[model samples]
Target: MIRTLPYRTAAVLAVALAVAALPLTTAPTAHADDRACEQYLHSKKYQIGPRVNQACRTAYDRGKGPNREAICKEMLLKIEVKPSHAASACRLGVKP
Candidate 1:
């Protein structure tokens, strides 16, 4: 039992260290992507209005980057707006 105690202790410590490090490693990458999505939404055009932009931003912040892009692209298509509209809006510092 005494000999086994050291092995058990080392195993427990290794598991604890892994669990503690996992979130730290993954959180920053997730946050950076979220920021990118927010910036993209705030800069996108297409006449999406403030409310729609805000909704998109919120959605992106809530882990919806891929979905947000799909929705925004669909909206642009439905409204007959060009992608350049979004590029211009981003350049002009517009929030819609």
Candidate 2:
């Protein structure tokens, strides 16, 4: 017994699978993923790893208001070493 999806259905499925394989942060922009954040952390002697990445993702997701850049800056400033502020800075056009 052999069954195959219609061409259109197969095309849709393929598109869905391709989209699914993409990194999760593609939508709403990947602000939290800019490499400058990691560089900033490294410059500050913080290790560029999971905790920092998680913090950035959290900050980006939580960011709100007409000034998401400012919101991100405020959030990151409260944390001393763990959160990287470079992405915020990059978005805000300010230095981290």
Candidate 3:
């Protein structure tokens, strides 16, 4: 029973290590996505100014996947902005 006790303890430790690593594995993806979104909005600072820039960022936060990109594009279009700006901005915001 003493020898078996060591084996059980090692098994418990290994399981604990794996469980701790689980949450960490998914953290980088979300963080990277947010950074990408912020960088995209930041890039448009000169062309859109603060108001539209904030609007674009808000739209991006509210959206997900392709829908998020679409929302940003729509916001830009509503303001009658340049097509190139909208397209590139939305593309970067939604990029993985």
Which candidate ranks first by lDDT, i.e. highest? 3
The CA lDDT of each predicted structure is 0.49, 0.52, 0.64
Clashes of each: 0, 0, 0
**lDDT per residue, candidate 1, 1-96, as tens digits?**
999999999999999999999988877432323234335545553344654454444434435444555554454445554566533322223222
Candidate 2: worst-modelled 10 consecutive residues by lDDT: 87-96
How much is the lDDT of residue 8 in candidate 1? 100
Q: Against the true structure, whose TM-score is highest?
A: 3
Model 2 lDDT, residue 69, Cα: 52
How high is each candidate's TM-score? Answer: 0.32, 0.34, 0.48
Name the candidate, 1 or 2, with the larger lDDT value: 2
Ranking by lDDT: 3, 2, 1
- List ranges where model 2 is wrong by over 4 Å: 1-33, 49-51, 58-65, 81-96
Clashes of 3: 0
Query: How well does candidate 1 score on lDDT at residue 56?
Result: 41
**RMSD in order of candidates:** 8.1, 8.0, 4.5
lDDT minimum window of 10 residues, candidate 3: 29-38
What's the CA RMSD of model 3 in angstroms?
4.5
- Candidate 2 RMSD to the real structure: 8.0
